[model samples]
Target: MNGVSKVSPGVGTGLSKPVAAALSIVDCDFHPFVPLQEVIARMPARARRSVQVSSYAAVLGREHNRFLIPTGEPLRLDAVPTRGGLAGSDPAFAVADYLDRWGIAAAVMMPIQAMGVIAWAAEEVVNSYLAAMNDLFLEMWHAEDPRFKMLISVSPHDPDAAVREIERLADKPGVVGFQIPMGEIGLGSSAMFKVYAAAAHFGLPLVLHPNSVDCSLQNSPSCAGRVTRSYAEHHVLLSQPGQGAATQLVMSGALERFPTMRVVLAEFGFSWVGPMMWRMDTAWQRGGGADGLLPRPPSEYLLNQLRFTTQPYDEPGNPRDLVPILDSMQAHRTLVFSSDYPHWDTDRPDVVLRRLPVELRERVAKQTAMETFGTRLGL
Candidate 1:
């Protein structure tokens, strides 16, 4: 709010010439940040006071992204606003820097800190901070630019509060879906059923964001049962939690209970999905309908309810080798393009387009995202 300019008309105005051909692309995983002080200022006095005493770093979790990169944060140096503000802190600048640059039709704003707070902060603090952050983005970003979409940030710790938050903002313009932080709590746990039900009622899907904190935190159970020692280690195994979440959703019969519910595993690699599906289907058949919970083979549930983002795209010795795996997973229907914008490892839309086979490019880039989100994206 301090240094960011108010958004104006004519997105892509910053570019010397418009790249009209790329305008149909939808970026499913773009990160936007609000200054912590701004979120603090919007909070109730009680929550403001409580958060003041808590260690901000501990409350937000130790962000390895900042230290892992040379720029003191995971952001690309070029993504920082030319007007002098942190990367992703300014919505108007992000429009010019990312959305405009790539001709992205809409870029979903995935606020990592907001998602992290849901996992790390006190219940009251988490609720209060999330409410304030939601309002901040609604007014500061969404209201200003419709091209910048958002996900409702909710905590799995308090299902009632999470439901209330979902109901409060589900109708807001540019709010596409719900994002829950990944931690010890598995997505398919009974405690999460209420949140899942609420999302389905509103036609909003749930998004799971895997993080380094979930893998290393002492109290939170790691998917691997051991803490990661380095950024690379954490990054490599990042998809494990996503795999676990997807497994739970299918095996626990969450999708069966809520037929309309959908889940998006964002920023988690898609390569593992093909093998995981095979393992799940085999286990489901051998275990007699997953102990009477699942009604069909696990892959059936996954194919109908789960979707994945393609970023940090899997590259092998031969790029052509990826075709069969992509086909096995029905990637054209399940995979969506994500730029992971502003991060050091961000992918360019054109680059991702080239990596994908010509037949799958259109759907992966835009169609799947539109189908996954439907009218919620206001596409």
Candidate 2:
């Protein structure tokens, strides 16, 4: 495979030509992922086989025959082109191409496959695979560009290993923080304390990404559900588990325990902020909840420790409404812009900005992301 070169602008490389040559933007959510097989290959031999067996079992156990066949595939391993095959299917989705085309200064890349799914396997298997995947991402993608940073994926099923992994990778260049799925292993469970503690100690954020666990829903009988239903369930489940976890962390004294830990609710959307904050505040003001459980209202803890990413935004809603909503939620500094690139429903800054006033656009696009990630525009 040929070494991939950064696609330069104005060379007609199939990217949308930038409207402003001087515009500097940083995309908080971009995904430039490696193949699963590549991640598998990087593991130790025993760990590699274990992952394969688990993956095979999961696929074969499924009722669908889709797992058995060798679907037609390609062997090329370079960054899949921004133009033909699976790569070019969406003209606007290429990360490198989009960065250059849109005049983005940098982007923080997240993994495509949710690492939490691997936690369904045995603990050792999941931990080893998670470590391998993180190491591979650090060595392969993030190392290639100083501007491209990554969120290290962690499996909370084994909190000890999760802590060790965080300690090992905390200082590694290009690793900005850790990514945890919303409903994986119940955030309120005692099992996750060590992981949260480790993140706090390292001064790295724990990003709660949106995903569905088999046992997350309260009364859902079987994990088997239609794909569309599951997708919808995943989105709705996001804030519920996150809120539950945040509440637990406060009530259980995780925040009192750590004091400096930060959490980011990525891609859970921002509409719920208003109501969630109101309810928490109301409960606290009335002294309706346990007094010794937390130092203040749950919303107060979240304001200090939590942040959220905005994507799949509702453009039809009044933009001015977001300002006060965030302020009331104490999330003004917590809201960051995200593109959710490569997904079907992604936000286009150029088009989204045209709808908003110039001041709002600058805050959401650049200032918010910079504050959240603790980095400045490379440009």
Candidate 3:
């Protein structure tokens, strides 16, 4: 971060590399939440009173205290701007603190907390809240910065409306992809297939962020069978739903149908990815898909159609242990760096991956993300 030859990428002050030369990143999981007031103001006149902008995940499991997870404010309190805005809600502060400071070439903006409202809000009101939040992000953040890219937040509860929103934003600058909850609905259902079709038509990927509830969801994801008691417990298992989503999407022919679409699993660790792929490939080959639901092995779809972010890198103690797992998962091309910034457990990019050899470092830090995001990042 200091004493290095760093040039400005021409967004904020200048472009610079993240903590170390090897760690210059294309940050894939930067969370920018909309301020509550802005969110409410954008709501339709009739429904604004009933629609709450707070997180609906608070009520998901009556058994566990979800409150303890986020600990402080969801965003880092210190990052809040002096100009009076929420921590992640301010574009200027984000640029000064995150993008320029880290020398990140590009950052994908996933404004996800707003969608957390959909789980408990009135069913009919879900689409409006999402649409308004999408508008708010476009106006407040996307228009304010060149380095920020957009991930349109939409729920699959109303597939037609979701498609309409996707089409509307598809042509807009920086509208790179969609962010949907993995467990909100079954990934391979026909309802979700329509949404995927819209994304494929637009040539945008879907970023599967972790969240397990939705007002209109019908089927339970194979993962998340019960609520856990601690933040650490919940954090450790975030990959379960991600795994379930990948499994459902592959087994049910969603990938087969939407061949051009891509998926990025955000903040979901990679330790389980290798094992999951092996199990699915094994089952698909031996159990038989005579009906042609799965025309090829599950690994083919998983490898070709999906990309994953590397943050909260599963290994905490010994960095050497990660080498074999990364090899098994073919992480050389699949992994991208993410700094779940401004959170208590946020991984410091300089410290986390620098221990790896330079070749692997280049893949995780830059090449894989450039390949996954493509022209959307102007790569």
The 0-to-1 C-alpha lDDT of every candidate, in the order given, reads: 0.78, 0.60, 0.71
Which candidate has the top score in lDDT? 1
| Candidate 3 lDDT, 1-379, residue by residue in tens | 5788766432334333445643567888887767656666777877677764333332222212242544644555556665755667678888877876776777888765644543443645666677877887888887888678888877656678778889888888888888875554678888887899889888888887764441112122233545444566667777776777778888889999988988888877887888889988778767644335887888888888878888777764877787888887888877788887755567767766675556788888888887777788765
Q: Give the C-alpha lDDT of model 1.
A: 0.78
Q: Return the lDDT, model 1, position 158.
A: 82
Measured with C-alpha atoms, the lDDT of residue 167 in candidate 2 is 89
Q: Write the per-residue lDDT of candidate 2 for residues 281-309, one digit (tens) a residue.
A: 67767764544566677766767777766
> Which should have the higher lDDT, number 2 or number 3?
3
lDDT of 1 by residue, 71-118 (tens): 445777767776676677788888776776677888888877675563
Q: What's each prediction's TM-score?
A: 0.89, 0.77, 0.86
Q: After TM-score superposition, what is the CA distance of residue 102 in candidate 2 from its true location, in Å?
A: 2.3
Candidates 1 and 3 compared: the better one by TM-score is 1
Q: In candidate 3, which residue ranges exceed 4 Å CA deviation?
A: 1-24, 53-67, 121-124, 214-225, 289-292
**Candidates sorted on lDDT, descending:** 1, 3, 2
Name the runs in model 1 displaced over 4 angstroms.
1-20, 52-59, 62-71, 118-121, 216-225
RMSD in order of candidates: 5.5, 6.8, 5.2
Candidate 2 local lDDT, residue 121:
49
